[model samples]
Target chain A: MNKVITINLGGNAYQLEEGGYDALRSYLDAAGRRLEGNPDRDEIIADIERAIADKVRGVLGANKTVVLAREVAAIIAEMGPVEDTADADTAAGTPESTPAAAPGTAGAKIPPRRLYKIREGAMVSGVCNGLAAYFRVDVTLVRLVFAFVTFFYGTGLLVYIILAIVIPSAETTEEKAAAQGTPAATAQEFIRRARAGYYEGMRTFGDRKAHREWRRRFKDEMRDWSRDFRQEMHQHANRWWQQGGPTWTPRSGAWFALPFLSLFLGLIAILGLWVGYTLITSGTVIGLPLPASMPVWVAILFLIVVIQAIRWPFKAMRRSYYCGGYGPPCCGPLGFLWHLCVWAAVIWFIYWLTQGGHSATLHDLAQHLPGKLHHALSSLKQWWEQL
Target chain B: MSVNEKFSSLRKGLLEFLVLKVIAGDKVYAADILQELSGTEFATQEGTLYPLLSKLRREELVDYEWKESEAGPPRKYYRLTAKGREQLQETLDYWQKINATLKNLGLKSRP
Candidate 1:
């Protein structure tokens, strides 16, 4: 007794023998490949399927509900090989033939190449094997290159992991054929690839099961750890609040802002010292378009004031946070009025520096500064020569 | 190429023109068109016919309407458009001209 498989074709259900199903599936796959790049590929395939359904229905009886392999083979033969239909399409001067048949029939034995990760004969995630296939190189050579690069900071391993995630594995026979640059356009090639896939699946079955079990265990451990950590944090926060540890008071808000203000001032002082050193060494400022008349300390002070103006709202936000996160109303209108005045002053200063008569003075400094530096360097060279 | 290959290619080229002629006759289902060509040298399978019909439709030379069928689901009944008739007339005229030229050449070469 042969095993039967049920399939839906053209919205009708039919039972097919296992062998018959395989043959039909491969035949349809070949047809689909043959019609690749055609605009109406799906519609034509649907029509072909409906025709196959009609033919199969004609052969079925009340008692003989299951389609046998020989009947399927006969039907495929009547429908003709996909190659013949492609030939007819090309001969008929259909525009689609240029793209679909160009690689297959234009004296090129290879199909259009696409990069796909191969699962068969893969050592680790199949990335190297896929790369070797794509570039038509030996797998050992590709692996050796990856190994050599991995010694330099392990970037090669990182790249391999990324590629494993990015490139799709060739799971189906058709995809495998496409990956190898030889699309299976005949039943023999399809069956060969399908058998190879079956063997690969069998070989990897045990490893796959172990990997799945390990992943499940890891996920369970992670979930339990996170739950415990969250509970501990919750209990600690509750105890601290219950002890009345300075919650949501103006004094506490001042205490929080003090540290940030000191840190900001320290950072600005370090930056100012660095800019002063660069200016002395280079005899000119690097990025800043400051006029030579303007003092470095004046520029630094202006920067500090501008940054403080921007940080005003953030300071208010910290105060609100100490007030139990109730937002701006907790701080009241005085803080908002102070922020508006600071922002208006900062904007007017920036506009004066960029657009007011100061810009022309800055431009004159930019043009003359380079020439002045050149003259000084020449005079220093003359003095060294005399010595 | 071999003689058989050349002849088959020529027949394939003419297949589309013949399909246009068939659709011009009446609004017909795909199976009906297949049946009409079954006995002729241009006989083709549904696998070949469907794509060809689709191309013809895409070119705006033919169109189809869904019609209910008794045996199964609704079928697409195909008919030629106005442009298809104009194209068919030009093709026919070109064919006659070629035929006349071939006949004249044949009579002169016989001497």
Candidate 2:
């Protein structure tokens, strides 16, 4: 007997059997997720609910009976498979316009079962174990069948060899899950459970004296294997070095220009500082006039440029401070500070330019133009007047 | 792409316009509209139709009011708004333009 559940869809109550209710709820949930980012998501869902309610009515007709699971499934099928709906939207060439509401629907469909060798249970070959697993039979029974076949004819050996060669081993967690018809959750969980079961089976001989024994044995096995691996790696490394293997080293001779570059950068930094000092003192830096006199913002801007110029060489020097295999030198904090100075200088410079600095600077620049250019400008002006 | 898939996609695009045209002709419930569209190429699943109606209503191209039914639960009767009429006219003009262009090119309008 199936339990009945009451559901509210589109402001109307529906009487649905438990299976139908679950299917409808999941379908609707999947649809909701598919249309999550849509602006009219709520309206669309509401409309879907109304359509479902109408479907329920059509199925029930005058009987007013509880809806069945098959009825719900039929309705969902008519609505079309969730994945198909998403695919159609994509195939329609309007993915940007249509949001994928059913992200989980992609994985909901189970892949087909495949045959895999079960290494967990095998005496001669994993063929019997794999066949048993595929058919959900006892491994002993499969072995008995092979034994009987061997007595009748020598084809059993050849058959077992062929099966073993063809079938894939259930080595990974996902492969094991596929072999056993179970969904793969995590490799760690699968490995832990497999180890615990294997050890438990082994400990059955001693009447299960200690539960912690299995864990200790597993850890010791892992440790021994790692130790042997490390020793082998050490031996290989020594052999490689003896055979004249190349080692990573910085090209010290290639960086011979560092000193000269540092000197040139230092000179530029000093010039910037001198220009900033002149601007502070006489409202002009390197013959470029400031806005009227030295405003606080302009002075601050000039100081920032001078400081950045001084820090630039230092930053570049740090970039190659520790080369070779040590990775790139970190200038995170210094870079952040330099960027802050640059932004402050830019903002202040823009403020100064907007506050009557444009005309004053242009006047100074225009007065410094060459005689030939000034004469060409006058001739062009006279020709334009005549035209 | 196969011919069937192309036709399917072409039909899917026109569904919304065809539905709006149906509602513009008369104020009708979902079942009635479905009945009218039955045996026609414009026929679509209820799941596909309802959401479209709701979207059109949201866009202010259509409006609906619930009325109690004799057979079962209340039904939402849908009618085209003034904006919907204007949209329908524009859609018709666009369709006519395309049809005329296709005719001038000596190609069949429907495939």
Candidate 3:
């Protein structure tokens, strides 16, 4: 069974077989490409579709409403190829050239088609027409394609609306000409070149009128340049931050904490080294006896403090690298809490060492320790006594 | 160029003049213009006529008004402007001169 597709042609609706729709759509597209940039683009396409719709209606009598591919092909053949119609127009314009040159070839120098909504004959935003010209498709078919997409997903409307808003309207003849990629210098560019006296030098003229013309063009060029510059600056002001330009947003909190973190890390390093040096040479750390002959608990606590001090800087560096984008390991308050934990761990280790050095605490810890550790401590005590 | 190509160009050269002459006679719609040209060698499609009409309109040689039609849609009724009449007169005079010259040379312009 053939699937039927609904299509709106020249304000009239018809249900056509899917294959017939494709055939008709492609035929219309060919016609549209040939007539791109013509002032009567919309009217011509509408007329063709109207004629075809009338023919299709005749073919689909009172009983059968479905239009098959063969019927569409027959209708297209009766209408004739779009190129013949275009040729007739071209011949009307330039009678000397039989089989007029393709619209796309502009003396072998076709400029890239720029996106611009044509001002004249625009329905709604003119995006569909502009796109049709750019893609060399029928405006009607382009609109139909957009309608289908919008019906299925609804993104087509959003995209079309955004394009309509963003694409500048081609208000002037020069803009309309350039919209079709005709390599014509814009008025601004012409004025700039004239002011530079490029064309003036080529002409063998050293007259006052020539100089006066140059001065006038120079004035116009300067005015246009200044206006464009002001407009650009105004636009930039709105999106300066996103473009990575200079902005007034306050520095991130990380910037403020960086110096403090460096200072704290340095202090911890110095304290850990001082404690280690004092314990090794003078048998004391922070005015507390944390000697090599202390209880196993005090020794283990000192080892942990030294290891943490060594690992702190490397861990912070890794965290910063990861926070750049890789992982959300250290960020804002979480980072601060991590630093607080490190500080607390170091201080607690220091406090434990000071108390563990006391003879009463050592004896308490000694009783709780395993018998093997007690024997080892007693042997160290005997050795210290001999020394 | 081939004979066919030359003939195509020859036919094309007369289309605008013919179109102006047709519009000058009566206020015509696009379909009417095509129908009138159907008997002539200048018979063309609506696609070609619309563009030419619009170009003529832009040049102030022709003007059109959107008139409600009993047919399918509102059609653009086109009429020749004063500028168009003057252009048609000039073109006709030139063509007559050319035809006279061709006749003097023992060649007739008419098929």
Candidate 4:
């Protein structure tokens, strides 16, 4: 007689005879632990079982009728560990936690469950907040615990790794509750292979009534997981507006900060230059050329000084304008292109209105740079491109 | 007996089979399971029993239905699945091989 193994897939039962119960259980346990914390944990676990099922029908090469432990172990070993962090981060950061609630019905709490706003900064449905509710602690405390662990003994890192393997990423509040269970200790290479989804996966296998409840909740959670990526972005953007910088540009938009600073300094410098140059050139009969008739290099230096004075404030406060992984200040190559188009349009509009054009002096700026300065500018441009 | 000796005598792999075997006949309750295992070589530990029983229930070898108890509010009654009965037969066959070897070595009697 051969003992058969049955695994739950989407509330459906799948049976395998060759590998038997132990083989199936071990595969589920190992694969489940590996996929602990990922957002799509359920899907990954389901896929792993599907993969196992696909390979489970055949007997060993010898006279064996049932699948052996070694074959099951080999299959799991071949699957490798489930990786939580993936290419999804570049586009979505993480899959959105469960489906959305009705617009007017936001912030309603689920019964027998704690709920709170998650880290709108980087999270799947304020994962931290929901966790805080379950732990009966402050959200900051939960975050701090994770942060401290991640920082010190890599406890947080291991937890994250296990979570990526075991804990499903929170999409809806219901799923977040599930991730809080199970204090993951080890990879337990053997036990996992012994117990599939039906055994150790449940909170307590004593009763089946709660499972029926979990199944119903799980359907809602799946709906939550299948939401639009753009809506998630909108939710994130909404989060920003609620607690972040105001959208309206201030009257003193630094719009005139640089221009004013430059004007003030430039006027002072011009006045000083006029008075000093006039004094030196007018009074002194000779002394290496007149002050007012200073060298072209001196004029070039003055222009450089004016540009720096104007640009300094903008450069200093540039960090304040960072738009969350947005490329760079509006002066990079792309920004330059955008500015060119906008400027051309504005110029054309002005040309249409006034029908006139004027030109400034040939700013032979780049030509006047010292060799070292030229190298610095080139490096800066390269750094901008890398960004 | 030392706790480990007591646990070993009761645990001995066959206990899982016995639990499944006993439950296979009827949808028995938790107290009923405790009473049945008591009559056999298997001695159930308080701390470990509930969790292990739960694990067994999850494996689908045992299925349970809730019945309101006269003494308490409600209690869960468990029974074996057809799959569980098949599993019990398989375990018994595996046990027979080991049990026969033990008896031949004069290290065991009828269990």
Candidate 5:
């Protein structure tokens, strides 16, 4: 027969059957472990307790004493499963194997768990430490990568802001454990590695009610993971783009000169041959060709100067310093070389076109003007120079 | 002399001197205090102890400070106040009377 007893909980006295007390004790022990990181633990526990009490009152109102364990178990099943401490206890380390509170000896009170903002940070969601608990990676690596991403494409920073908002902060002992990568902590990153842990079987006790809650959390994790994964992919692609479009990539300081360099090099090659060929063709624009009779070897030398002399040297310099990642250059010399080459090409092309034999294009504009008009323009230029 | 006589006396008979005795020896955080109690088989739900200590604080019997931790947030440590020491003195005196009364009846061992 079940015996009557009044056990004190916290400061409140609870009158329950002997059988009920044992069940409550075991259930609470299990529930405490599960409720570690969950924010709504107290509310959930209170609700479950009230439900159990109501069930007990209903049964005992008719029968004065001697309630069965079956009655309480039935009620608990409707609330949620009891923690499966068998395996969890091994992982819990200290709390499980330790004895429950002893009588007469003073209990040292534990302060409530608190969440402080992390320090020594880079742009990693301020939540990377939190994420590391989930993923089990070195904090340093996360920080390093985070720095690089923020340095380039600072716009990508909004992703971290989104994460800090979307991801729940750890604020309790259980949450801290999870945030630190302890087994059984519900850290989403940790849960991801467990493979088998996704649903990890129906909870041991509180079968019906717990199932509903479990399903909800599972769905939430899926959505959050998908969003996080997508963000990660985007960052990776942006990094690859910054490396180079093809041979000799561009950089910010030197990147702006790329278009001008191409134009300069093309103009130099055209002018070199055209002017040399113009000199060969009696200074008329007779489809300028390389001055072949002037010695093919010198022409070859001239071609080298045309392409490689100014621009190629700078191209080599730009090639040397071309490091990627907007965070900061780790001293990439090729990048500097490429920039120099571009400048050389543009400068040399402009220099040759003016000083080298006149191009038909420049001469044509001169010829198009009427003789009288041309004389008047020359005189106007002289007048302005004198002033 | 009815139920309260039995239950109240039962509650009162268990001297709360343990409370003073616990705090008298050393400074402690609430968690350590609970842990010490558990070792002695005195079970406590965190819910119960926090309120008890909060009352102690309110009465100016105890004081606490927030201390930082490397891995986590700051912790609060409790120390006895001057008023707390006076309360302890009064409790000791009251205990002496109960022991004296029992002694007058020619009962008990060490007073």
Candidate 6:
């Protein structure tokens, strides 16, 4: 005695076996997801449901009351996969649209590829496997490339973390199909691929063994190349020394440092001007008689400049890395200027501390406090009398 | 490419044209249309036909009327609109032109 459930489809109640009902529900849900953006989605779905109901009635033939799972499967197959219906709609819209064909078949068009991290057979996060699948390259090659890049300032580690966050995982059958560039047009296709473990594209045992062998060979080749490179470097150094110790041109050496020197000098000049203005106005640079509110504003300005100075280099580095180049030369020169300003600010702050700026400001405040306090008390008394 | 895949893709491109032609013949029920094409290469499932018909209706190339059915609820009987007939005629003309071009090319290459 199988469990039976009554479902309302196309305004008619039909008794379906539990398994059959689940299958039908999932199929309709998938179809609904596919037709999400269509204006006539409800009508189309209704039509499909009505057609299914009509077919179910024919299958029943006044004898069977409850639809069986086997019958439902057969009915679904005869009606064709949900993807075929969706694809037909899209194919009409785009004249040259390629219908997704089942993978591993001759003349099958590979589905448009998407990067999705695989969960199965993953070493760390399935980033490398995802990359390998997308490019149709060996997983070992991708892992090796990442391993090599990691040696350079841990760039690969940073990139991996970012990709892990940004690239979605292959959670759904459709997403898995997209990750592998395969077509899971039908439920049967998905089941077949799942049974074959096809979604575990590149991290199988055989591939792992091959990767180990490749890594060992790579290490051997690297050792040989380094030894040869060191020998060549030694020979060049000896030849250079024998020719003439080293012709160090003063102009050439100074040319590179000139920009740094000018920027430093400019920073010092700006600092000196600021100090002079404060000294001339306030007898003690920090004893400016301005309202107490001014200090907070100045501190906020200082903080803003400091944070911007610190953030510039990291932003530039990220941009250059993601943009796939050494980035603009302005990044280097501007970065130096920002650093110089930050250093200047630090030195000026230290100078102020050492020069008793804090004490002088305190002293100035103390002098003004009593008179201000007396004035405030009198104003309070007058306001109380008026009240 | 495999011949089967090529044929299917070709059929897919021509399926809409065939659907328009079928509707142009007479006002017909969806089941009747399916039956008419069952023996031909243009035969398709209800799942495929319903969506195609829905798209056609949305595009204003076809219109449907709800008519009482003998056995069940009111059924949608479809017929081509003026725009649909115009589109069908244009497609037929284009197909004929291509057909003639293919024949001419075949004749020129035969000897």
The residue ranges of model 2 lying beyond 4 angstroms of the native Cα positions read: A61-64, A81-88, A91-387, B106-111
How much of the true A–B contact set does each candidate keep?
0.26, 0.24, 0.14, 0.00, 0.00, 0.35
- Quote the positional error of residue A204 for candidate 3 in Å: 75
Query: Which window of ten consecutive residues has the lowest lDDT sum in model 6 chain A?
Result: A100-109
Clashing pairs in 2: A33-A101, A34-A100, A34-A101, A34-A102, A35-A101
Worst 10 residues of 5 chain A by lDDT: A101-110
Docking quality category of candidate 2 according to DockQ thresholds: incorrect
Best by DockQ: 6
Extract clashing residue pairs from model 6.
Answer: none
Model 2, position A173: C-alpha lDDT score: 40
RMSD per prediction, one decimal?
A: 24.9, 28.9, 29.2, 26.5, 27.7, 19.5
Candidate 2 residue lDDT tens string, A1-387: 455789997677888865566566656755565565666667667767877787887888556678876677667655532222323453331221222322112223333456888766455337788788778888889977765554322234446655776898887544555676654322223234434563345335444545355446546744754565466567667876996774434357535655666677677667755665465445576777766655746565656666675666565653454343333323456554646444454444344443442545544654576775888899999999999
Residue A150, candidate 6: how far off, in angstroms?
A: 38
lDDT of 4 by residue, B1-111 (tens): 556444452354445677787787788765566577665556442212343455576577777776755432345677877888888888889889988888789655768
- Over the true interface, candidate 3 deviates by an RMSD, in Å, of 5.2
Q: Residue-wise lDDT of candidate 3 within A121-224, one digit each (tens)?
A: 34445898888877777888987776655543234555676687689987643455558665443223333444565344435336678656655764674475
Q: What residue pairs clash in candidate 3, if any at all?
A: none
* DockQ of predicted model 1: 0.16
State the lDDT of candidate 4 residue by residue for A1-387, as single tens digits.
234555553333555443344434533553444345545456455544543444443333345535554565554443333333222221111111112311111112233443434332323235565567567777778766765554432345345433433434455323333333322212232334334533343334345876555456545644643343344556667776887644434344556554665566566546544443433234332233446666533543443345444544454344234332233454454554443333333333333323221111112342345765988999999999999
Which parts of model 1 have CA positions greater than 4 angstroms off? Answer: A1-8, A14-42, A58-77, A80-89, A92-109, A121-124, A135-156, A171-174, A192-387, B1-3, B24-27, B59-61, B68-72, B81-111
Best by TM-score: 1
CAPRI grade of model 3: incorrect
Give per-residue CA lDDT, model 2, range B1-111, as digits (tens): 555455766777776788888898888988777778766756555545665676677789999998887654577899999999999999999999999898788555877
Query: How high is the DockQ of candidate 4?
Result: 0.02
Q: Candidate 1 local accuracy as lDDT?
A: 0.67
lDDT of 4 at A122: 28
Provide the lDDT at B94 for model 5.
Answer: 88
After TM-score superposition, what is the CA distance of residue A192 in candidate 5 from its true location, in Å? 23
lDDT by residue for model 6 (A280-321), tens: 336334464545556533643454455455555555544444
